[model samples]
Target: MAEPTTRPRDAALGSGPGRVLLTVYLIFAVAAGARALVQIATKFGEAPLAYLLSAVAALVYIAATVGLAVGGARGRVIALTGCSIEMVGVLVVGTLTVTDAAAFPDDTVWSRYGSGYGYVPLVLPLIGLWWLWHNRPRDRA
Candidate 1:
């Protein structure tokens, strides 16, 4: 009989520290998505850009959370993609919100580098990338 396949300890997605990470991501996903839904449903015209950006941020968070919770090669890729875009989004949006406050009269998840959410938005991507890298697939001899 063939031995069962198993991943390394670090490759566990929803285990140990990954469980904490997953929980946090889930929270943000709900918060950002709900906020966006409310903003768009109630007063999108008041701040269309902010509302749309919030929606996009919500999607990214959802993707990241799902990917991490479903750990595998595909999951790693998804998580990495989501995390990468998240980092870029936070950097660009943070700069825009700071340099041109008028452009962003309202807040998105990335606004002020995630200051509205205690900066977890800014740091989450970095940690996600690290997790992905740590669990990266190894070449067999």
Candidate 2:
């Protein structure tokens, strides 16, 4: 008996460059989450705002990873929102960290355009949004 293997209409989201994107997102999620957890658990008082922003970045990366893995209409929407938020956060945080170093007092994943992480944080969302847009569902009329 042949078993039925259903193919997802949006499976493309997790293939090709999308796979690389997902891997990066997963790495960032783990990295940011771990860093934020350790900072918050240990020296939170030293940089509460930075630590909190790191935690938020972790959450956004996690959401984007899950959305890319899910690979469907809803997943696209989730990924879009996650990437959009990430882009804004990185830009705003990066600018603030550069213009007002005293206000930050500590580094986040998005600090200085993600200079701490090789600037991947600054470029990731742009790639993600482009991937999502490129793989968007077409009308099957």
Candidate 3:
């Protein structure tokens, strides 16, 4: 009979600190998606770019949450990509909104580096990337 392989301490991404990270991602997914939906439904013309960006942010958050919850090689890839995209999005959008407010004309979740949400939008991806690295898969040969 083959011996059972041991699971690493950091094997499960949804365990320990990962739970908190997952919760935050879920919350942001809901908040950004809902806000974007409402804005698009009522007054998309008011700030189409901002609303669309918020929707995109929400999708990224949702993907990250799912990746964390799933917790495997595939999950790691998904989470990594999502976090990378989110980090870039926040930086680009935040810079644009600050350097030229007229370009945005409205706030997305990442506006001013997420000043509206206490900058969680700005920092969450960094934390997520770290968490993903911490929980990376190990070879158990």
Clashing pairs in 2: none
Give candidate 1 misplaced runs (Cα > 4 Å): 1-11
List candidate 2 segments past 4 Å from native.
1-9
Candidate 2's TM-score = 0.93
For residue 135, give model 2's deviation from the true position in Å. 0.3
* Cα lDDT of model 2 by residue, 15-108, tens digit: 6676789999999999999999999999999999999999999999999999888878888888999999999999999999999999998999
Our model 2 lands, by Cα RMSD against the true structure, at: 1.6
lDDT preference between candidates 1 and 2, better one? 2
Candidate 2 positional error at 123, Å: 0.7
Candidate with the greatest lDDT versus the true structure? 2
- Per-model TM-score on C-alpha atoms: 0.92, 0.93, 0.91
For residue 123, what is the lDDT in candidate 1? Answer: 97
Candidate 1 local lDDT, residue 91: 98
Q: Over the full model, what C-alpha lDDT does candidate 2 score relative to the true structure?
A: 0.92
Q: lDDT at 129 for candidate 1?
A: 90
- CA lDDT scores, all candidates in order: 0.88, 0.92, 0.89
How close to the true structure is residue 106 of candidate 1, measured as C-alpha lDDT?
A: 90
